[model samples]
Target chain A: MSEFTRGFRAGIPIGIGYLSVSFTFGIMAVSYGFSWWQAVIISMLTLTSAGQLAGISVMVHPGQYLEMLFSQLTINIRYSFMSVSLSQKVAASFSGMKRWLLGFFMTDEIFAVASAEKTVDAKFFFGLSVAPYFGWALGTLGGSVLGNILPEVLMNSLCLAIYGMFLAIIAPKARTSRAVLCVTVVAILLHVMFVYLPILNRVSSGIAVSVCAIVAALIGAWLFPHDEEENEA
Target chain B: MREFFIYLVILVGSTYLVRALPFALMRKKIKNRFIRSFLYYIPYTVLAAMTFPAAVLATGNMLAASLGLIAGGVLALQGKGLTLVAFVCCALSLMTDLIMITLN
Candidate 1:
């Protein structure tokens, strides 16, 4: 199968998982006094759940544009690390304008799936992006137009799909690799600390996630650095 | 409306720049063993960090969410596909929610 087709297939689950999350976002945005079209436009332009949700609050509260900029930069800073890591995985031919375009669609789930591949290229990146991008936008449209129709229980349940996908991505790798297992455990512990500790709990979720991932990965790297030759093979 | 548009621009610009600059600037692979390993382990670390307490609280009921997490984790470890794991997690969480409601 072609690489693009393969990537497209891989992205289908991520796209499906995005529907419920974005649906929630749409409902929230509309309830915040945004028109349905405005909510859809925000989803199309931003394509980030946390950032968009945070942005909606800022807009509704008469916050400054500078506040929006800082909030987005802080919340989305994790993408820089993900993007740099993905940059190394892409084929040499994946460059120039395509890099910019591909970067635009670099959501967390897309990064997870794309970085899992042996090699990423322009076709694969674009193909992987299509489903989730449209799923996000279309889901927003649906939710904005039909707010609160779905039962709250159903909505809450559907939110688990994305987390399930994350587990699916990490579980097998952690099972096989001692380094991955250690890193996963350490990251989870760090996240728990951030969520509950008095001073740490004040840290925004985005910054907490980035710090936990970096610290956990650094520890893993220090103790179990990859052998270049073994990795190539 | 114009103010909203400006806010949108700020949000899009800040977020997009962070994502784009890193990808666009880093054209060559790093040969450093430590950095390479760090990058290699990043996806696992990020996913794990994102999943834990967040997933536990996802369904608004810790019990139901935990059940879904365990079901998803076990299915994934058994080499289930992503779609199946996600589907089962959602279904299980919904069922747990229903049972909790009935009991209440």
Candidate 2:
């Protein structure tokens, strides 16, 4: 397949997933009394799920800016890490314009799709990123405009779809490799700790969860020796 | 009105900062093995941590979470797809809720 086609094909699942999840986010922002444009703009500008959730908290509790900032910083700090990982994949020939444009769409789904592909260049990743970019903006716009026309139960059910997508992405990897499984287990344990522990409960969730997950995953990877062949690029 | 703009500025600027800054700074490729491996697995690890608590807790009630957990775990272990696992668990939970409601 051509680079463009590969990118779009890779990006297709992400686009579909964005449509579903961003719809929920749109409904949420509107329900919280944001204008339709505001809902649309938020989804466009900030593509991260947890980041958007944190933003909602900030919108509701403006005085808690510091808390929200910490949470958002925590949740999104991983993106920098992903960007560094992707630096090798993106072409050296890419123009400054392309770099800036591509930077706008460094989402989890986009990252997954782009990074997983074999021999895809920057153009391909950029191509895949485009559809989700619009899908999110439009999905949020539709949700904001539609504004709870559906039954509450149905809407609640739709919310689970995002989690479903997440599971689908990780489960396939976990099924194949013990390394992924170890990472998944470590992450879950760390999450449970913060959720259950009283002392940790005071910490801002974004930071606490991010730190614990990263630390745990790093330690797990260090202890579990994966076969060398699997690690090669 | 000013507060609204401030919030807007923060939202836009922060989003741009997180997304845009790295690509600009890391002009060359990252050939480092350790950081690359760390980046490769970070999303899955982060996502597991993020999603598991909510999926397990299933919204504050242990009974509901346990029921959902059984449905999800069984279906997942059986090699059903994720949509099936999540929806089936949720549907089962909803049915349980309805049954109790009707019985009462």
Candidate 3:
């Protein structure tokens, strides 16, 4: 198969996964007083799950513009690090413009699959991203418009679906890897601690998550450093 | 309407700023051992933290959510793929929710 098709095929599963999460976001945005189109637009523009969710929360509650800015800054900061790591793996000869385009669609799921590749082909990158991008936008649109049509109970129950996706991503890794299990457990504990702690609880959710992830990973790295051959490979 | 538009622009701008800036700046390879190892462990750890606690709370049915998580965990340990794990978890949670509602 062509490189583009290969990437697109690889991304199809991510698109399916995004549908579940973005659908929830769509319903959430509308319930927060955003119109259907507005929710779709937000999904289109922000493209970050946590970032868009935080934006909706900001809009719902009257907040300073600066607070909203800071919130966005804090929420999406991890993406910068994720983007940087993926940059090294992307084709060295890829054009600057394509790089910019690729950067915009770099969600965690996309980054995970793309970064794991031996080499990121530009066409593959394009094909890989297109499905998830439109899938998210469409999912949001559907949720916004059709969310109300569902029974309240069903709507509430569907909330578990997104978490299911999250579980699927981590459970397998933790099962086989001792270091991963240790870090995962530590990360969960730190996250719970932060959310309950009086002072730290005030931290924006995005920043709180980043801090917890970094701290847990720090401990994991120190304790279980990768093999020497695996340093940069 | 106008205020909404303004915030949308600001929110979109800021989100993109952080996400894209690193890609723009880091054109070359990341050579630092510490940073590389750090990023390597991040996805699963961060995802683990984000999923748990929030997952249970999100369902609002702790009993059912816990059941789903345990089942999902077991399935994942058996080398189940993402689609299967998600499917089984959602189904378990849904069944639990249904059973509880019926009992009530």
Candidate 4:
């Protein structure tokens, strides 16, 4: 099989994972007065979940544009770092525009699988993105169109599936690497600290999360430097 | 909905900008040792930060959510695959949430 096909096959689970969460997002949009089309468009244009949710909150309350900008930017800035790492792995021949297209689909789940590779082919990246992108868009369409129809229990249960996916992704790495475990602990501690701090808690959650993650990562870099071999190994 | 529509443009534009910046600027591979190490760990820390605290709200109540988080962690710790771990936690959290609701 071609590398693209391999990547596409691997992406099936991620697409399903995104469907569950973005389905919730679609439901959320309608409840907040957005039309089904708007919700679908949102998913199509911007695939980031936390950022979409934050922006929807702004829509619900009609917050300042700057607040929306700051919140979404901070929530999604992790992608910048992810893309930076991915840029190295992508084929050296890819142009700036191609790299930008790859950046568009670097959601958390996709990044987890993609970055684990020693080298990334452009075709492979496109294959990986297509299914998840479709799943996200289609799920949003389903949810917004079917909003308020499902029983409460199932929605509640499925809502956590995405978080479960997140745990599944990180837990393995944490188990294998001491440095990873340390970084995870530090980030969690910092997040908890921010959540409890009254003034800080009111700040954009994206910013808070961004700060905590960056700090934890910085500490990890300084305290537990690894050789290049360890990276690929 | 004009506000919503307008913000859609802003949100999508800004979010895309944030995501695309590093990819555009860092065309070459990172050679800086500390920076490379730092980028390597970014995913781990970021994912961890997003999962916790928030995961505790999964089941409609703190008790069930907490239980679900612990159960998910344990399952994941055992080196289970993604699908199995997620489904187990979803089921566990749903049951805990129902039990809590009926009792109250």
What's the TM-score of every candidate structure?
0.75, 0.77, 0.83, 0.83
Per-residue alpha-carbon lDDT of candidate 2 for residues A124-199, written as tens digits (9 for 90 to 100)? 8777987788888888888778766865544544444445555655776787777878888888888788878899
Alpha-carbon deviation at A53 in model 2, angstroms: 2.7
Model 2 chain B: worst 10 consecutive residues (lDDT sum): B56-65
Q: Which consecutive 10 residues in model 2 chain A have the weakest lDDT in total?
A: A224-233
Tell me the lDDT of model 1 at A203.
80
Per-residue CA lDDT of candidate 1, range B1-104, in tens? Answer: 88898888888888899889999998665678897787777767877887888888877888898888899899999878667887788888899999989998
Which is the winner by lDDT between candidate 2 and candidate 3? 3
> Which structure is stronger by TM-score: 2 or 3?
3
Candidate 1 A-chain TM-score: 0.69
Clashing pairs in 3: none
After superposition, the stretches of candidate 1 with alpha carbons farther than 4 Å from their true spots are: A1-21, A24-39, A48-94, A107-128, A143-147, A228-233, B1-11
Clashing pairs in 4: none
lDDT of 4 by residue, A68-175 (tens): 776666567667767776777777766577777777888877887887887888788889998999999998998888877876775676666667766877888889
After best superposition, candidate 2 residue B34: deviation in angstroms? 5.2
Q: Provide the overall lDDT of each model, using Cα atoms, as 2-decimal numbers.
A: 0.81, 0.66, 0.76, 0.78
* Model 3 C-alpha lDDT per residue in residues A1-233, reported as the tens digit of each score: 99989989999988887887788788878777889999999999888776787678678755457767865765466687778767777777765777776678878778878877887878888889988998899999988888899876666656666666667667767876788889989999998988888998887665566678778888988888754433121
Query: Across residues A1-233, which tens digit of lDDT does each residue of candidate 1 receive?
Result: 88789888888877876776677677767767998999999999989876787678678755477667766765576677678778877888899888988899988788878887788888989889989999899989987877667777877786677677778878988888888899999999999999999999988665677688888989999999986543210
